[model samples]
Target: MTRETLTWLNTMTLIGHTDRRGTAWHYKASEQGGEPNHYPGAIPLKDVRARLFNWEGVHRRVAVELPASTFTEATHYGLDNKPMRWEVIGNRSALDRSDRDTGAVFGVVGPDYKIHQYSDWLLENVAGLLHDGLSVSSAGLLKGGAVAWVEVSVPENLMTDEGVEFRPNLLATTTMDGSSATVYKRTITDVVCDNTRAVALKESGAEFKVRHSKNSELRLEQARDALQIVDTAADEFRRQVAELCAIAVTEDDWQLFLDRTVPWGTKTGKPDNDYMRLLKEERRENLTYIYRNDPRCAPWHGTAHGVVQAVNTYDHHVRLPQKKEDQEPDRVSSWRTDRNLQRTVDGLFDELDRETYLDLEAVLEQAA
Candidate 1:
């Protein structure tokens, strides 16, 4: 259901094959879009460990070689045990662009977007099929991996005379391909970074055209209550499960943990009072706050624990349907429930601490 955003054209489904001893297991991932879903999530298994698939025939993992450019989010689940999608902006260890038309550190793709030049005032809209598609955080390669969120940006200095580059490799650059093969191409053009774009991308717009850069909002807090859980678990010992158990004593545990953990975690580019007010008033939460720096998680965060700024609630989030004797709209608000909200929470624990007893997909990856 989620596809084609600012940079996301389609998704490539993936599955994980791992070794028990922490050895890396390479399961082939396909850049193939669409689904002939092979693993029947509906098919009941003799083993209780197996989680049934809700999107059974929707996504399947196949192994195939992709150009170095395609990227995917390291993690794909939301606070709930449901699947979510994200953009894997280029490789972490390789350069991400090529030198083409312009000469800027982040080579010119097309021309600089003239936000101020309202000369035409004509907004280009992708009509019909694209109208309903996802415009942010649409994962392109659709591969899956468990990577911690990192805080860094594409450096201007890193952009050589070539193109906008990064370490590892770039993503979604398969502009051309061989015969008999259908190639996928997604481009980021007229690239310029500015506050106006951010303002326009947030909630409340003309609703005529979809913004293509879906991942633009992944900054933080977009997950709503789900993000609060991540804030609590940021410092939970990896080799222990009790940390989460203490919080899962029923969902109320989250409210308790969040109150304790939420206030202290810092927002990126935020003053203490402002960040606190932002946390108390708004929905978009991003950038984990760091403090005096701890020993274990400190190396990752600060002396304290904080993640990225909360995601901007400017877009959509979820609202759990309330019982009202059929008096209400039957559905919750579109302000809630994104793909990220559906992914398994158990997996998150696994990512935090290997000693975690909860299996990420096991707890939440079920039929809604």
Candidate 2:
């Protein structure tokens, strides 16, 4: 249908995740008015086909018409000296497609725009991962059927000696709304906090992106080869985690980090009034509490990795939208969280030198 026909919250969205990560964000399916969409294990390919993407996006030509008011007696007309009630205009409208009742108009595109069927996308990108012990851990749609994603993960989780347990995942996403190009990327999820992180140290080369051009389908083999490189991402991530764990942070250093990362006073550098000071103190206290006691962050408390985990946990779980209406839908929130985590990861490494505390301070300063 059209966007006006759908509710703002939870319209034409389905999120299913394997129970390994607990329920898919508890409130994701609340508007669906039934049980939360949680599966016992990896979701089967057949189930995904049957339940989520049964329709295709077919392109339809668009046409335009003009009213006859602009015509004059000088123009060729019928014997009445009046033009037709409506005249056919040039085809100025762009072609686009959607499932008549179940999806929204995906995008307005030119003649060269290709319609990549979801079925073909899945078969070419995701289905084969199932055979290699990588299963579909999460899959869903958002904004009607304009965007879709499937997350695949290895069944066996990995842990560093310092006790950071994580699962590396391949996130394959496509959007008909032109928000992004078709992308297959590598990401890691911290099991303790369920926060997503980018697997690559640098941002540029981690994912493969294909534009929606006529030659999109022909690039499938190259995409698969890129994914083979993605498959080895966890090893490098493990090495980095171990390195972070090896860097020790003293109590004094932790306090300095908190001061720099969560500065006192206001953004203008003015001294805080009583109420503002209380709020600021509460923020610091909450972060310190998470650093000292939260299971997600405390296990590696004396190390650099612990500081990173503390900040990530606080951001993911402790932070809240200022207004209830400001809350994002689960899919939108998930996408934003992944991007935030990646920034945190990249920011930390960009400032890390592994030799001095000043480098660590610089990292937190930049992060703040």
Candidate 3:
């Protein structure tokens, strides 16, 4: 299997989600032949420590022993005019010994890269949220422990006046793979669709990031301010939803929007082959069905908010898996899906308004 496929399978075995007040659907892992990994309510910190992030990332110097025959006397001699037998390279490898990926090398990093133990960071940063009545909703490792995340959310749910119910969560994520920095960001999960939305509003930022360096611990102390977003994200998201709900979208506009968002041709402007054409048509039909009949979207139909919700629900629950064989479906990686959803949200909202008719024309034009 490919690295991405391996990562998806590894992530599925390590992640667990809370019931979300009995609203969260069984994760894709359960549907892909694995038993459901769901907790009844907020997952206890102890449970998170024991079940998910029980291991530490250890730093080891990267080196290789060269055969004496391969080196010339002139090249192998040290500045002291003596032969050198061993030397440490400038880079180090972060290794995890956990059963999930025993002896797996998470990343190669510079000499200055600091190893941030998952359990220690959680104790310092996330343990306090529990005191404020927030509970750990989800905790997991991805990419064979190269990346790890813990989501904290309120015990109950919040609802908008337009009848959209959601839970605001603070996602504390870090990586040993150099894919991301230590980040504390706010996200909103729709109880209806179980779709996680990035809470990146234009006015107030929703995340704090700290690089993997000697001073990361100090910076984490300053990031406590970001944690306050959990208290404010609901109101900001409520306002955003209201703005979108107020914009009217006619049936014709919906069709045009779909035409531009999911066009039916190759990038070279040539028409698709028969098989590709059929797949594109099926995709469009699925989105139409979601917009008109899916409970997650129908409640807000004929509005811009509904259109966005339709696309999000499709990406989360309806889109075809990238790889499938026989009757079993391949596990879809949430990491890839989340990145796509973030881009989709940005594009759909970049110029969305009553006058624009969900303008994603610029994005599509560029892609074309």
Candidate 4:
């Protein structure tokens, strides 16, 4: 195939050919060299490969999407945009495992943002807390290689009355796809159920949506308060939960609330045959069970906060397919699910006529 020039957003042009020097790729620019931090000039593929190998010897061979962030016009490679290390198969083993997977012998690797870099940031970020005896309870990469998070316990004083050990976590996600901006959120995770809710409920944390385009350095500087933001948000979350529990929802109110929050059945009060309609029924059942059966939810059952919790917990933890094939790839992810549900429910609760308290009668009256 002929080498094609891909000029990304008028920043740089990536020109490569599969037939060039037995699968070699190169880009043209006015810079002194395509090498990161070098003055602008056209650079060959050899320079990139030589620079990477000199920095570090190969440990594990993996498929890395390149040119490196430093060279790429799209990605912002900097201290904050640290690469997260990825696990790759060993040298000979990878070749033996796949007949079609020929590895790139001459390519840049180090200084490219990967998973390990993210883990390094997590380690250093919480090093002080580790001294105080808080360990990283959970940390891993999410599916599709775009998101990762690290969870750690809050201090004893921050614990709620329920004595449940809720840990606050830091999540970072980005997409090569144009659909989303690079975003980071401080969230609270219920360890028992692995359900997560963003702590940006009221602007409580370092929740930021950063453009991958330009001015990334300034944006990263703005996110320096991420640690403090999570701490403040965690405190607020505890306080809000207590306040939510104090508000009550009577049986009539609960039923009415469900009518609005999880409306099921038809005009005839019979289940709808439509699959989407039946899903609402299933959600209602799950919400009901969460309200009635979950021990954590028992105290605040039928309350405004309780209902929200039921919805969030079900959306976050409970609604899972029993089989791999049953999984809905589009919407099941924590990032997409939490964003959609939280936005929808928050909007529902924050509507103009909606008052501070969870009064179903008041809401119904307002609607009427």
RMSD of each: 24.8, 6.9, 6.6, 19.1
My TM-score estimates for the predictions, one after another, are 0.19, 0.72, 0.77, 0.50
Error of 4 at 198 (Å): 3.2
TM-score for candidate 2, residues paired by index:
0.72
Candidate numbers sorted by TM-score from highest down: 3, 2, 4, 1
Encode model 2's per-residue lDDT on 177-288: one tens digit a residue: 5556676766777777776665543333366777888787735576566556557877878887887778777877777777776678778989889987886787789878
Mind sharing the TM-score for model 1?
A: 0.19
Query: What would the per-residue lDDT of candidate 1 be over residues 58-102, giving only the tens digit for each residue?
Result: 111122222333235324445664554544333111111132223
For model 4, what is the C-alpha lDDT against the true structure? 0.43
Could you tell me which residue pairs clash in candidate 2?
A: none
List where candidate 4 sits over 4 angstroms from the true fold: 1-137, 150-158, 162-165, 176-179, 200-206, 218-223, 265-271, 274-282, 320-368
lDDT of each: 0.20, 0.61, 0.64, 0.43
Q: What ranking of all candidate models by lDDT puts the best one first?
A: 3, 2, 4, 1
lDDT of 3: 0.64
Residue 183 accuracy (lDDT) in model 1: 11
The weakest ten consecutive residues by lDDT in model 1 span 117-126
Off by over 4 Å in 2: 1-19, 27-36, 58-97, 101-111, 201-205, 265-279, 327-368
Residue 6's lDDT within candidate 1 is 15
Best of the candidates, lDDT: 3
